[model samples]
Target chain A: MKLEILAALNAEREARRAAVLVTEIATGKQRLVREADLASDPLAETLAERLRMGKSGMAETPAGDVFLTVQAPPVRIVVTGAVHISQALAPMARLLGHDLTIVDPRTAFATPERFPDAPVHAEWPDDVLPKLGVDRYTAFVALTHDPKIDDPGLIHALRSRCFYIGALGSRKTHAKRVERLTAAGFTDKDIARIHAPIGLPIGAISPAEIALSIMGEITAALRLKPASAAQAAA
Target chain B: MLATDNDIMNRAEAWRREGKGVAIATVVETWGSAPRPVGSHLVIDDDGNFLGSVSGGCVEGAVVTEAVDVITSGAPKMLEFGVADETAWKVGLSCGGRIRVYVERVD
Candidate 1:
C-alpha cells in the first residue's frame, strides 16, 4: 500500500510537470497544454487572460487552468517504399519540417547516401513498423506499388490511426488492393480511409509532380479539416 | 509573473496547485500580412499573469484586457485584428494583414 501510494504521488508530480490545464468557464471544458518556454514569448499574456476567463485550449505552458499542449519538433513521416517518388518526397517533406524515414527491403534503393538527410531503414515493413510504433501524429505512405511491401504497412497504419496514409497507384490498382485488404478483414470504411490514387487531382505526370501532390494532400490533412469535411465546406 | 527559463515549469505547477484558472490563446489562422504565423500560442492566468505571445505586441494589451473579462465571465472568444482596424495599427502590427486568434480556457 505504501509503495502504491508513492507511485501515485510520483505519477501526479510527473503529470503536473508535463502539463498545464486550461478550463473554459462557459462550457466547462478543460484542455492540457504541454510545457514549453520560448523566451520573448508572445503568447504569455493571451494565455493568462484566457485562463482568467476559464477558456479551455491547449497551450505550451502549465500555469493556471492552462494545461500543456506539447509539440514535438520535426513531425515524423514514414515511407514504406523507396521508389523515385520517395526520394523526391523525402527532401520536400523535410523542407516543411517533417522528419522523414524511408523503409524498404530493396537494399539498392534504401541507402543512407541516396536519402542523405532521411533515416533509411533497409528492412521489410513488417519488421520495421512494429518497432516504430506509428502514432496519430505520424504520416505513413506506401509508394512501393508492390503489395508484398505495401500491404503489411497499410494494415499497420490502418490499425494504428496514423494521421495520413497515402498509396501511389491507379484506381484499378487500388480496387485490386481493396480485395486483398477485405480478405484480411479490413472493413469497407477502413479501406476507404486509405488515400489511394494518392494526392490532389492536379494532373500530375512525373515522379516529382506526384510527390508534390502527395505532400500537398498530406499537408492539407495535417492542418485543415478532414478530406470529406473539406469537400463539404468547399 | 515574470519567469526565468528554468522556473517556467515550476511556476506553472505552483499556480495549478493553488487552484487558479488559466487561459490560452492561439493564432489558428492568419492571412494577408498578419504579424505572427499560425500555431503561435499565448497563456494567461486568472489574475492576469501571462506566458508566451500571439502577435508582435500589437494587440497583446487588448488581448490581456479581454482575457481578464473572459476569466471573470468564464467565456471563450475569437478575436480578429487587421490593418483596417485603427486599434490594430495603434498596437503596432499595421502591416495591412488579418489574423484570427482563438482564445479558450484550459484547466
Candidate 2:
C-alpha cells in the first residue's frame, strides 16, 4: 500500500512485465517481486516455480505464509501465414486469451477483412519479426508452406527463447525442411523445438479443426512440462 | 463482461482511492475436479458488489460472504473447501474437488 510500491506495480503492468506482489499473511508486510528479481529473493526456489507456472498462490515458508499475486503479461503469438488456417487461428488464439499478429508477404491474403481482430502485417518476416519484438512469452508458428517466409521466421524465433515454435508441414516435408535448416546453420536441438506438422494429432482435417489442434498443442506446451520434470516437481 | 486480472486489480485500487473499501478473493490452490484454475480472482467492494469469479459454481457464496467482513475488519483470511468435508459441502463446494482461497482487504 506504499505509494512507491503502487507506482512500481502500475509501471510493470504498463510495460507488460511479469511481476508478483508478495504479501506476508501474518504481519501484512508486502513487497513486489518482479520476474527479474526472483533469483535474489529469499524464497527464490518456490518463487521461480510459481513464476514459471505464472500463478498466484499461498506459499508456506519458514518466515510464514506469503500470498503471491502474479501479474503476468498476456502471451503473444506471432504467425507467418495468412492462409485459411490462419483465418481460423487468429480468432481462436484471441478466444484462448492470446494476443496474435499475422505476417504474410502476400497483401492479398493478409487483409484486415480476413483478420478483423488481429493485426496483419503484409511484410516479410525479416522486416516484421523485429517490429513484433518476439520474447520469451511469444509463440512462433509458421503456417505458410513457402520455405522462404517460414524458414526465416523460424530462424528469428530460434534466435530468441520464444516458448513454442511450430511449423506446418507433413513429416516427409519436415525432414527436408530440417535438412535445409541444418544447412542454414541451425543445430539439431534448435530444430527439435519446432513442432513439425504442427498441432496435436486429433485427426484434424478441416482448417478450423487444425487451428483448434494447434492451439491445444500450444497450451499443452506452455502448461505441461515434460513427464520427468513434472514428477520431480511433484 | 468478464474482467481480466489487471482489471480487477486496477478497479480495486480505484475503489480504494474513491474511499470505498475493497477485498480480493483469489483461488490459491486446487485439487481434483477444480473448475477454475489457481490465481482466478473475484474482487468485492464494501457494498457486497463484485466483479470476476473465483469458482464457476463452488465456494463463491462463502468467499463473498467473508469479503464483507474483511472489508470491515481489515484482516485477511484463508479458507479451504472440499466435497469430502461436510462443512465445505454445506457451503456449496460440492464439485468433488478441494480448493484453498485467500481473502485480503486491499488498501
TM-score of chain B of each: 0.74, 0.87
Model 1 Cα lDDT, one tens digit per residue, B1-107: 33322233334445555777655566756778877666566667778887667777777777777777766666678787766454434554567787767675543
Instruction: Report the number of the highest-lDDT candidate.
Output: 2
Q: What would the per-residue lDDT of candidate 2 be over residues B1-107, giving only the tens digit for each residue?
A: 35666666677777777888888888888899887888888888888888778778566778889999988898888888777465433765567888888888876
Deviation of model 1 at A27, angstroms: 24
List, residue by residue over A1-234, the lDDT tens digit for candidate 1.
Answer: 022222332343343232233333334454344334432344557553442232334444444333323323234789988888988998887677576789999999888888876889999998999898786557889999899999999999888757788988899999999999999999998888799899999999998999999999998887675333322322
Runs of candidate 1 exceeding 4 Å displacement: A1-74, A226-234, B1-91, B94-107
Interface RMSD against the true structure, candidate 2: 3.0
lDDT of 2 by residue, A1-234 (tens): 443565577678767688888888788788998888888989888887777677678889999988887777777899999999999998877667688899999999999999987999999998999877887778899999999989889999978767889999999989999999899999998789899889999999999999999999889877775222222333
The CAPRI-style docking tier of model 2 reads: acceptable
Q: What share of the true interface contacts does candidate 1 keep?
A: 0.00
Query: Which ranges in model 2 have alpha carbons more than 4 Å from their true place?
Result: A1-14, A53-55, A226-234, B1-7, B10-20, B84-89
- The TM-score values for the models, in the order shown, are 0.57, 0.85
Q: How large an RMSD does model 1 have?
A: 11.6
